[model samples]
Target: MPPHIRIYDVTQNISSMLPVYPGDPGFSREVLKSLEWGDPYTLSALHLSAHAGTHIDAPSHFIRGGRSVHEIPIERLIMMVDLIDSGTVVSPENLSGLNPLAEGVIFRTGSLTGYLSEGAARACVDRRLKLIGTDALSVDSSEEDAVHRLLLSNDMLILEGLYLEGVPAGVHTLLCMPLKIEGAEASPVRAILAPAEWHQWIL
Candidate 1:
């Protein structure tokens, strides 16, 4: 309901060609009927992993008996976010200047570096962040998934596969709401970013 000077679409386009996490199902679309084929109207079905593209991860993803996607309130998804450029590695030292007022933090790593160190995750925990987003597919570079468990067990949400290539680094209004699929651990989202000043217009 408020005007914005600029808006950044941070969601990745889901298509057959879109790169997915290793062992995860690639995105696909089937056209059961189409106007191009003389059908009355266009109809199609999509198939993709819940974590495909830009998606948010619920605590159920790693923590046993944790909250699921639909269980999270919409208010938790929309909030003030501080985007940080943390290079290839996200460490505690680099995250020391996090914005105190921001509820969410998105790390813009120039490359697809799965380098969310344990110390870095702990730093976020110390700050009591509600959400932690990253351009990488997974927060942990190691196969142990320590980072995932550490954050999720603390009731913190994880947002992955963000498109932050040209997005500026600073405070902004995050508009990312996951699909409300009951019992789903993760869901694709159309994440967007607007100027932080737009927060005043949000109720």
Candidate 2:
């Protein structure tokens, strides 16, 4: 086996304590069987929104007749990613000088106010990026619909609610796999980042 490279988990823990979007179902677990009750095994049922925690948004999330979670190509989920910290607002100016061919771009927005302007979203599409990700819950809280439409219409995947607190800004190999829920618009993912050199070994 090849030597293991360091990996950073960018996913948030799905638990009752984790926050959810307004009106979205919070994470919860109901025990159906328990060892405390002398049951043969412990089994629990989880209840949460598909967008809970670290998740990928299919085009169908905003566009009618768009591709669903199961329809997304796996190649789009794993790729080279540019991790950029644009603070609160990711404007077009923030994206200046970036590699135009990066398969994915992950914004490490440290605050809830962090979001992409419509112009920035267009820039991403113009650069031919296949995916966009952010640590924030939503890319544009004010003009969310428009922003989402701009990206999704261009066949760009959106990853939201990433826990990128300590991740460095650089090119990394992203390995994010969402559940293949048929006809679902979104699905939670176990997102991770590793050195770009690890890509070949991982594949």
Candidate 3:
């Protein structure tokens, strides 16, 4: 028999109260009432950074004269995927292992939680990846910020702070939907992976 349908959630856990960026407030939730409190139902309130955990950074994140997250076209939120397991620094040659249809690329560097080296970025681009996503804080070298500029200048959409440990590398349907926060540079997203056939679209 064939394998049962599988859905891989590629997103991070939402913390009602957790650490956030420097000088930025993390998420906080307060329940006003509940059945246990003898009220009709439960109600809650929340506060969090627009660019907190597992977020998508819009062009405006760095470029002052760029489009905000809301201004971005919704079409960019969904695309065919390739979860490339580079295993460390993504080599230029690793790109060849990727399916060309994965215009939306989410790379995994095993346990990497920081930026990338210039060499890695160069290798990635040599393979013609358009959009870039990573399970780290950023996808480029932090010292010079060269890799960041290289990819962003080419109109790449950067998905930062993903948690992709067990996902397999292959053709999959990706649905990464960020919050619709107007004028915000970025927002957290709920990312997921599923079989292409389940989405009724070929990868």
Each prediction's whole-model lDDT (CA): 0.90, 0.87, 0.72
Q: Kindly indicate the candidate among 1 and 2 with the higher TM-score.
A: 1
Best candidate according to TM-score: 1
**If ranked by lDDT, best first, what sequence of candidates would result?**
1, 2, 3
Per-residue lDDT of model 2, residues 6-100, tens digit only: 78999999999987777788999999999999999999999999999899999999999999999998877888888998888888877886755
> Per-candidate TM vs. native?
0.95, 0.94, 0.81
lDDT for each residue of candidate 3 in 6-90, tens digit (9 for 90 to 100): 8888877878644344456777778888888899989888777776778887777777677778887776777777887776565
CA lDDT of 12 in candidate 1?
90
Q: After superposition, how far is residue 73 of candidate 3 from its true place, in Å?
A: 1.7
**Considering summed lDDT, which 10 consecutive residues are worst modelled in model 1?**
108-117
Going through the candidates in the order shown, the clash numbers are 0, 0, 0
- Return whichever of 2 and 3 wins on TM-score: 2
